[model samples]
Target: MRRFNLKLYLIFILVLLVRISNAHQETIRVGFIESPPLIYNKDEKLVGALVDYLNDILPNFNIKFVKTPLSRVPDLLDKDVIQIFPMYFYSAERADKVHYIPTSFHALNPCLCALKENKIPSTIRDPKSFEQKTIVHLRGTLKNRDFLNFKNTNYLELPTQDYYEKSLKMLKLKRAEYAYFADFQQVKRFLNNKKHSNIHCENSHYPKDEMFFVTNKNFYLKKNLELKISKTSFKTYLKKHLSRVNWQVD
Candidate 1:
């Protein structure tokens, strides 16, 4: 009877241990920003290219998403409020704080989006061309810094307090004259549903850059997550997304 009681006690302890272990297992926190086609809010749900890709690949992994404005994403990473940002480009400053996944998910081709009626130069071969234009860009985003490279251009940055949709609206309403920069495909996708034929992307633009997954230095599951991402085929997902978009447009 003592042996039987001992066995039951041991089983109870094992069960408690298992529960504790389960409780302590970290749930990966992936940071999301409002970049249309890549990530955006729809009907209060996170939905976009990156979201769909993550849903397909991370079903078996434990994950929680934190969605915020594009500008705040960098701050959240700096504060370690989030563990992972699904897509990021490398820079010496940013590289110091985060570990970049070895694989690149996509190439980002950013361009100037302006109203066709404005007759904005389709090609931007000469930096001198945009001398006095009231260029508008999303505040605190990659574009803000990118535009600074054009020393000859004077650009006005939109308030970060506002949303990206507002920037598009401003362009549509001709509130800003030119130089609203964004990913060409993303801008095209955004314009598809809108009633604007005047909006078009400039042929000449910033050089293409690759985007990769990046995680904070202290994230617990960093090693395992990076391993899985390395094994995954990013092009497969990109192809699928493109096909879907083409079919929908057709």
Candidate 2:
């Protein structure tokens, strides 16, 4: 009778342990926009440096990646439709809507590109120098406030759905004298392609912007996510990952 009672007790403890472990693991829905080489769909699979990094670091959580439009991210996050969003620049307007991890993981360098054949002067080193020039960029990605320093520059904001192709078309058609990209590495990828050989970017004078992972205001695991990332050597991991993809990380 003593042996039987001991066996039953052990089974109960094991079951309780299993239940506790299961209770701690959660399914976190992560929202992502189409930013190639960082986060984009390929062969029907969502794959990129950020995707791989998150999957590797967050083993305790089941991450479900959801493709979201760039413009709808803030609303989706507010509605609790997605628990987390990666690779977003910090802005006062955005901070009100989401909780930003205290640490920034990457610095995105701005790039101003123009067609080489157009022979646009490379003297445009500052916002003041962009006077009377028409620049094109993704709509939601940039705002009039961003170029407030420019006196009389014209900005043609394209839709975010297929911004990469549209921005390139705008430049090639001479509709815009310059194309502005938030990340130099992303623009470099397009410039490397033979089809876009005419597009060339001059050394940028704009300051680099830091990018961070943001979570919904009420996300239960926000602190846990921040703690995990804080403990990891994310900068080293990001440098290696970017190098592998032929992107320069500074």
Which numbered prediction scores highest in lDDT against the true structure?
Answer: 2
For model 1, what is the alpha-carbon lDDT of residue 191?
Answer: 66
Per-model clash counts, in order, read: 0, 0
User: Candidate 2 on 51-70: residue-level lDDT in tens?
Assistant: 77797778777789887766
List runs of model 1 lying over 4 Å from the truth: 1-25, 69-75, 119-125, 143-146, 149-152, 159-165, 238-250
- Per-residue lDDT value at 50 in model 1: 81
RMSD of candidate 2 to true structure, Å: 6.1
Locate the minimum summed-lDDT window of 10 residues in model 1.
241-250
Q: After aligning candidate 1 to the native by TM-score, how far in Å is the CA of 178 from where it should be?
A: 1.8
lDDT of 1 by residue, 44-124 (tens): 666667876776666655567886455565678768777788867777777776778777777877777777776766455
| Number of the top TM-score candidate | 2
RMSD of 1: 6.6
- Against the true structure, candidate 2 reaches a TM-score of 0.77
